[model samples]
Target: MPAPTLRLPSGDTWTRAEYEALPDDLPVRVGVVYGELVVKPRPRPIQRRVARRLATRLEDAAPVGWQVDADVDVLLDDDEVEPVELAPDVVVYSSDHDPYERPISADLVTLVVEVVSPFSRRVRPSLYAEAGIRHYWRVETDQTAPAFAIYSYELDDATGLYVATGVHHDRIAVTLPFELDIELKGVREPRRRRRAGR
Candidate 1:
């Protein structure tokens, strides 16, 4: 008989080494929501491609001192668990700091992006808010409705909840960090279908 795996309580803290030892494989993506583990299926090609594209855009748009990372895990301390692993599709960390194998919190990440799945939606954005991430984007990749929804928030130092600054998209021409303006059309465009009888 196989032994049951022991589960940790909520808000537990674990070291980086301990967090990496958890049994999670690629293609089946995983993240920590509070102290519990959340698994997701691997992203499709379009999603991956779009994420990469966004990374490139941020790189060019960001100021000289900023850096971008794709699908990297940002750690958040949960008392019962070693650390919460949050692997956003795209994240930006300031170049003025050194990188850690496991982040103590989502504060290391200035921005986090997720490409919405066709079926299920991952709750990482809420988790990121809990972990103190500042900016977030929820990408809807459905063929019928392709759009990127941008969200910005101010983190409460005392509460740790991110308060939304009212959602803004490319239409607003909001310039961020590196003096770069993000346009929505770059992320998506309307497709024109041709008539078969034409």
Candidate 2:
């Protein structure tokens, strides 16, 4: 059987009211990605769990006038295609945010953490870098060794692209607005099975 289809109106810009009127039963999320109304799959359990852990870590480590949110929308433009929804597993925004809604810009964010899913590993980080995000961490939970591989991007003079400056394991600490440290070893992956009767 074929999956149900969603009838998306053809255009570049859409109002929040127009976005809301789409069918609620559709299995897609309507968010703007680079000025287009993009529909993407929702995150799975491992992804959700990673988000929770990162949020907790931030809340504990962050100082006053800083806040964190997960699975929230961020408006990159005035149109409906906001470029980033389902943003950061953990995102740090300035103190003045509306209680009911996500912020409009990726401004004043010190850290943006992404728990890289199998399919999204390559593309997601690049998107974040393009948004002028200062720092990003890519967590890989699907490795044989099961480790969180960290990557840091800094603006380069010649290339005009953010060059990866650091990569580390076991623990990671970022020094942006404040000092924050996370121990990745605390996140345990499921043990692999041995051959039946070895």
Model 1: CA > 4 A from native: 1-17, 22-27, 78-82, 96-105, 118-122, 144-160, 163-172, 189-198
lDDT of 2 by residue, 38-102 (tens): 65567777767767877788778889988787755554333444334334566877667764754
Tell me the tens digit of each residue's lDDT in model 1 across 69-105. 8887777555444456767788887775565554424
lDDT of 2 at 39: 55
CA-lDDT, candidates in order? 0.64, 0.62
Q: What is the C-alpha RMSD of each candidate to the true structure, in Å?
A: 6.3, 5.9
